[model samples]
Target: MSCQHAPSSDGNPTEADSLVIKVVETSAAGKQLSELTKFTASGADVVEITIKPNETYQTITGFGGSFTEASAYLLNQLSPDNRQRILEAYFGDAGARYSLTRTHINS
Candidate 1:
C-alpha cells in the first residue's frame, strides 16, 4: 500500500503526526485485521477513531482523547449499525450504554 501525507487547508503539506495507511495489495479482511492490530498496539493509551465516508469529513470529532471512551460515547448517540461497525473495528466488541454524563446545568 502507498501512503500519502494529507495537505492542510492552506494547501501546504502538513507534517504527519500520525501514521496513515493506504491499503493497496491486501485483502479487505486482512487490511481490517492489520489496521486494528496496528492501532491497538500504538501505545497511545487512548485512541479516537473517526469513521466516515470518503466523500465527507463530517463525522465523529476526535477530542484527541480516549478511543474506547469516545467510541462508547458515539455508540450512545449513533445508529446501531454505525455503532456496531465502529465497535467491531476498534474494540472488537459491541454493546451500547444508555446512561451518559452531561456537564450542562440548568440556569
Candidate 2:
C-alpha cells in the first residue's frame, strides 16, 4: 500500500514519510519471540539453531552502502526515467529499503 504524503507543520510535503513501506511478510520471528530451525550437513553432521529474541543485544541501526562522486555522477548522467528506476530499485519498498548510507570523505 502507498502512504499518503502529508504536509508538515511548515507546509512542506514530507517526502520521506510518504515512502513508508508496509510489510506484508517478513522472515523475522514473531514480536519478542524467536524461531528455531534444524540443519543437516553433508552426511553425518546435524545441527540445531536457536534464535533467542528475548536476549537483549546491540540493536541494528540499518543497512546501507557507500556513495561516491563517481556513483553520483553516473546516476546524474542517466536519463530521468532511468534515474528514477535506479532510485526506486535501491530505495523503494520493493527494493532493499536501505536507510543508512555512508560515504567516504576522501576521494
Best candidate per lDDT, number? 2
**1-107 per-residue lDDT for model 1 (tens digits):** 44444555765444443446544444655554243322222565754444333567566532222335554566789888987676555444343322233332331
Q: Candidates' lDDT values, in order?
A: 0.47, 0.62
- Clashing residue pairs in candidate 1 are 47-67
Name the 10 consecutive residues with the lowest summed lDDT in model 2: 17-26
Candidate 2 colliding pairs: none
Q: What is the lDDT of candidate 1?
A: 0.47
**Which regions in candidate 2 have their CA more than 4 angstroms from the true location?**
1-44
- Superposed by TM-score, candidate 1 places the C-alpha of residue 19 at a distance from the truth, in angstroms, of 20
Give the backbone clash total of model 1: 1
lDDT of 2 by residue, 1-107 (tens): 22234456765544343333232433455533232333223375633333355787898988878789899889999999999998888888999888877777873
